[model samples]
Target: MSETRIVGLRTERGWTQERLAEVSGVTVRTVQRLEAGNDVSLDTLSRLAGALEVPLRDLVAERAERDDTGNAGSTDDIDDTGGPAAGDDAAARHFADAARSAWRDIALGVALLVTSPAPVVLLIAGADAGLVPTSVEVAIAIGLGALLAIALVATLHLVRASGRLSPFLPIRQERVRFGARALRWAERLEGVHRRQRTRATAVACAMWVSSPLPLIVVALIEPGRGQGLWIAAATAVLLVVVAAGAFTALRTAWAPYVQAKLAPAVEARATV
Candidate 1:
């Protein structure tokens, strides 16, 4: 069976595999397998296509074209190890720079979003614990102010990042021709990112599962006054831990995620 444009289509809309699965009513693993070029039933394909709002034929046809071009006997643009040739060094650099910028902005924005509530949480908790000489209403007002400011900053940053990728968006959406060299570069980039993502995700999962432990321990050990402060502190710590993990994972994954969407572009040219 021919491959599908699930990855490109999904990414074009800025949707993750989990998001796509949720919208399409399928398992995340199934979406992963499908994007990995595994075979699937027509019903499954139809469901995914419907969710992506694209005709099923377009998805299958797009990949078929790419497969054909990739299978063609063309090694002039490839090195001995099947990597991008010297001729493509400039193109690779340009693509890498753009991809890196977009990745950096997106990761930083996500980090901001996750950590945005930390200040507010800490402030409110501290006020409640009497550590800060402020009324609860005043604390809430200040916290909300901080939260809104951070949220606005993050929103603007992400929007700018998305705008910066306008040139590459077509390639990502598979609307333009992409060469084999770019595909190889994307594959290599993805391989490196995969390792980093694995480590970060594992760490994040561990942190998340243990986040509540601190609060639990504090509550159990101290059943008297000032316990609220400790509990609030623990909650603040929990948010920070979650933020760090999320930031690390997303930071490591962004470039590859964006580039991977371009990997399936039809390799009809000698260079990107």
Candidate 2:
């Protein structure tokens, strides 16, 4: 098998390569190669253990330590040391592949969003450029398109950042030791996410309660266009809520699949 005992142990716990990288600051590729074999350089192994905050022997140990979970089941029964329990290997493999290709995906996504503005420019400068039949439609499209573009660009950037930061994300370990070899990325993502959501909910409620101050500002500046400005500002606020709420929901829901992927890595680290 390509994977070593350490890899299997790590998978049983759940952790992503990215998380391991973060805790260890080793290159993702190094994690990849080491997991594949027992032949890593001593210097690399020492650093990896140090980053995982564990002893070198813990990482290279050949057996599972006592089951603190006390579940009375072998590793296979709880979940395959092969992958996260939430999905079949195919699904886990998919995200792993995506993570590997993250830079390319982000690059493509950005290129598309950046060039999206071209269509509007074409409409304005081409044969149909002179069609000013309804200013309102053009204006509305402009507002929505701009907002959509902003959202897309922001989303793509976020994807790239997450991919890069994933190496060291924590997985569900018995404990977050100074030296665990997290095979999984995050164990308590849902709990962490819930706390953040609560805070956001409070902030949103506060903003909603004080919603009209922008109108006052615009009205003071320009009586006629004040309502439009206020409406736009309100739309922006609503967008923020929707986006934040949606991300929170996904974080909680997809927690299983994501956590599953990294679980082995985390478990591996715990022992290593």
Candidate 3:
């Protein structure tokens, strides 16, 4: 492919040479050389086109046309069908679904962590008001503790499952189909930054931490007081805000990854 076409495509996507190199599995030096119109091997060209989400022939043909006519072709002449091979579309769909499911799993974990204290709080309140016997409260606490333990286990398992996938490792078909879809999706996704995953995890933790604050505030305020309703209303508002913030943050962090991961498959399908 012509260096100008490669450079144009990369710049149009706002990709730096380093970013392109990382996504294309090439060295930064190689990217620089290619951009400078140095000859690149067929394999290298193929990688670049894949990473840039364009057809290989389009790059080669555009370069050939430019050389023959002594005029660089228009950007519109380059085919933008940078998509995965046809056979990969099914795998891509599965990975996308898995990524989405993993997010839900994480959300469920956060919900469990956030709500874990509710039973205990209720038990304490009931005992203080002489509405519950000591024996019953003890039993309830034990049950809730067990439930919390189970929730924690499930949460950790999900987190581990969603951890980063290693591209060098051979992934089993069953795993791709049934487990760790998040990792699979990440492996397939181009241009996913570590910061995005970190931010998403942080936001989820923050949501869990903040979720109980409203209930704690309500507990500190006397329910027998005339302001109980006001306290409840305020708590509801706070919970809503926390939920909304978590939703927005998680979506912001993961949406790009998902879109990038699926772009090739989507484009392939479109071309068909």
* Number of the predicted model whose TM-score against the real structure is largest: 1
Query: Which residue segments of model 2 deviate by more than 4 Å?
Result: 1-36, 39-134, 161-201, 212-230, 233-272
Candidate 1, superposed: residue stretches over 4 Å from native: 1-93, 267-272
Give the TM-score of each candidate.
Answer: 0.60, 0.32, 0.36
Model 2 per-residue lDDT tens digits across residues 1-272: 12465565456558687777666556888888888753544335544554555544455344223243452323321222432222223323334444435433454454344444433443333323334354555745774587578658757776764554343232222222222222233445535555754665565456555555554555566445234434455444444444444433333333344455466545544454
RMSD of each: 14.1, 13.0, 15.1
lDDT of each: 0.66, 0.46, 0.55
Compute the lDDT of residue 251 as modeled in candidate 2.
32
User: What's the best-to-worst order under lDDT?
Assistant: 1, 3, 2
TM-score between candidate 1 and the true structure: 0.60
> Of the candidates shown, which would achieve the greatest lDDT relative to the real structure?
1
**What is the TM-score ranking, best to worst?**
1, 3, 2
Deviation of model 3 at 38, angstroms: 38
Show where candidate 3 strays beyond 4 Å: 1-90, 135-140, 143-150, 153-254, 260-272
